[model samples]
Target: MLEKVIRSPLILIVSLFLMTIMLWSVYYGAFSNVFESVLLFVLIIALSTFLFLILFHNKRNPERKISWKSWTPYELKEEDEGQQWVTYRATRKVYIFFYFAIPAGLMVVAVFRHIEFMPLVVLFVLGTTQYGIYWHESRKYLNDREEV
Candidate 1:
């Protein structure tokens, strides 16, 4: 379970969501003393553990250092030409997604101009969507390979 949690992108997504919530609460002055404090504590611990796990993994597997070096939403274990190709395809899709998503997000923000935190919400959505697209594409390719 710990290894799976370390490898999964879900932790990154959750952390980002938590961070967005914290930022929103701070900006709007809606932070409850108890709830927000506990949230902040959990967020800190999760991120710290994630970082530690990543570093430990790198130490245990020196060959995977390259994979850890360029961590991003679309990052994958590019162990071979085939994996690299999959990553390329996934990233291209993400780029295309952003091409449309950015404009749509901006329009939504403009429409909801009265909301002071609309930009942050848009950013959060876009960020999560990018990772979701990458994760989906990576899984699809992996599954296809496994079937073959």
Candidate 2:
């Protein structure tokens, strides 16, 4: 279970979000005070360790080759044509979502221009919505296959 969670795209998404938050805090001088500085140091160490573990695990996996020179996003293995089709469909749906979502998001940001974190809010919403669309489309395909 732990390994599955660690290998999932969910982990990558979450780690990226956390890193963004950390950077935002740093940029805003949220850790300017001594105690907060120490806390920030600890968080940096922890996140570094977590990322190291992920790298180590990826290194040990023979099937998933990762290198600094050629980085690839970790995705579910598409061993057959059917799996590839599912991925293609999911990607298409995500593209379609962005086609509509971008304009809507811009309008939302314009309306909420006074909110300090409105950009981040819109980013979070867009990210989650994209993932939701991909997951739902892929799951629907898998379910149809299973039902047959």
Candidate 3:
């Protein structure tokens, strides 16, 4: 169970969401002083650094670093070249929404709610990084497919 969770990037996703919400709360006088904000910031940085090291660390064999079991939303089973190409294309399009639209929507909601800006900025970074990861994975998958 622990290994499965580690293999999934969902931890990173949840971590970002929680950290942002906490930041929003702390920054807007939810904690009564700057100490609380500083504490939250330290914790967020620590967690993010740990997760990033686990997610993107490269040892001797870089290809062995990432686990495919929980990285993608797709099934990614055996398929013909055409089918695989279609899957890759679909993944690309989906990430386009994830990259820009999601962050923009979040910011719009935040603005309406009068939330702090730092959280939204982190969210935008998360969105952009998620897209970059998805793009790199798609490219690698497509290239591996062609080689096969």
Candidate 4:
């Protein structure tokens, strides 16, 4: 179970976010001035990410094996390997969090923490780039090619 979650890209990304939050908390001292609502929101994001992966993990990515070497987005291209429809759907669902949900959460944190909004703006841009990259790669997965 642990290994599978660790292996999934979605899980890893969310984990990175959670780690960033933890580091911030540690640096700023335990949500000392931040509202509980903000903390609750962060927890919800983490839990939802984990649950989403748990539900979809086994269902997507079938016999087609994309080598571990190409798992990193920067190293990958628009080669269709895994199940098309399923992978596309999963990619969209996950990006909703990356492109919208996480930034909203960050904005909420910024509001409560009295931090500058620029960082969340930067996060939004990063999320947009991630979505663009994902969309480019996943488009190939959206169609089925008749074997020649």
Candidate 5:
């Protein structure tokens, strides 16, 4: 999981760097603008395709190699119930922490760099939405548990 997180951000960083270069090249008219735009678009698409293939190929396997043994429905239901509440609570906490931390970090960086407010507002909204979704889901899970 740590490797997965690190790897994805590295890809994003590299992509951003490439995009910056492409933009600078276009601004300087070092290359034909049309050709540069097409090349950048193709690069982005190819990178996304490659990443998706690497990430999801395992889950997209056609072979059903693993078989499940029979179990009582009630037993399986109870097993799922045992972990649901704790899992939801943990997930909620994680989302809440990230929702605050990411924007706060971004704001600090933006202040240091004298960046504009529009990007910070966008980040704030995105983080708030994430927090809201996690909170709502966590509450629903808790309510469901109570009803049981």
Candidate 6:
């Protein structure tokens, strides 16, 4: 749908940008030197913990749903059975590649190169994508709810 296409790309792009900033900070500020590396490691761990807590809170608090009232047009409807099937298949592919394949490949490369930050970069990218997907799905669900 037009709404999905428009919003999904925006979510993906924003997530990628955020991840890039984090990666750049790690590479240029922390990983470049010994003290920087330790600082970066601590910062990354703290941020990761904070993110985990936020996500957990959002998941646990079911009453706070995404809002779609602000969305324009509001013409989108619930995905039909056939469309749902296609979405399921596409989601499976995305899950397999983004969640599993990419991380596995990155792990192999990190191990072979003995570079510590490579894995973290990969994880950051993966986390970004995961967050983007969650945002997109939540938006879609909210849109559908508004329609109904």
Q: Candidate 4 has which clashing residue pairs, if any?
A: none
lDDT at position 133, candidate 5: 55
Clashes of each: 0, 0, 0, 0, 0, 0
RMSD (Cα, Å) for all candidates, in order, is 2.7, 3.4, 8.7, 9.9, 11.8, 10.3
- Candidate 4, 1-148: lDDT as tens digits: 6434434445545655665555566555656646445765777887776556644643465443333433454223334555545456656666675767666766667676756444544554465556555644554444444332
Q: Candidate 4: how large is its RMSD?
A: 9.9
Residue-wise lDDT of candidate 5 within 33-113, one digit each (tens)? Answer: 787988798777967765565445435543511112342211112236545654556466766767687777667767766
Order the candidates by TM-score, highest first — what do you get? Answer: 1, 2, 3, 6, 4, 5
What does the lDDT come to for candidate 5? 0.53
**Tens digit per residue, CA lDDT, model 3, 1-148:** 4334544456556666666656666666656567666767777686777566555554434764545435554325325876577566656766675768676776676676664474566565655577456556665666786899
- Among all windows of 10 consecutive residues in model 2, the one with the lowest summed lDDT is 66-75
Best by TM-score: 1
C-alpha local distance difference test of each model: 0.82, 0.71, 0.60, 0.54, 0.53, 0.54
| Clash pairs (backbone) in predicted model 2 | none
Sort the candidates on lDDT, descending order: 1, 2, 3, 6, 4, 5
Tell me the TM-score of model 6. 0.40
Choose the strongest candidate by lDDT: 1
**TM-scores for every candidate against the unseen true structure:** 0.83, 0.71, 0.41, 0.33, 0.30, 0.40
lDDT against true structure, model 3? 0.60
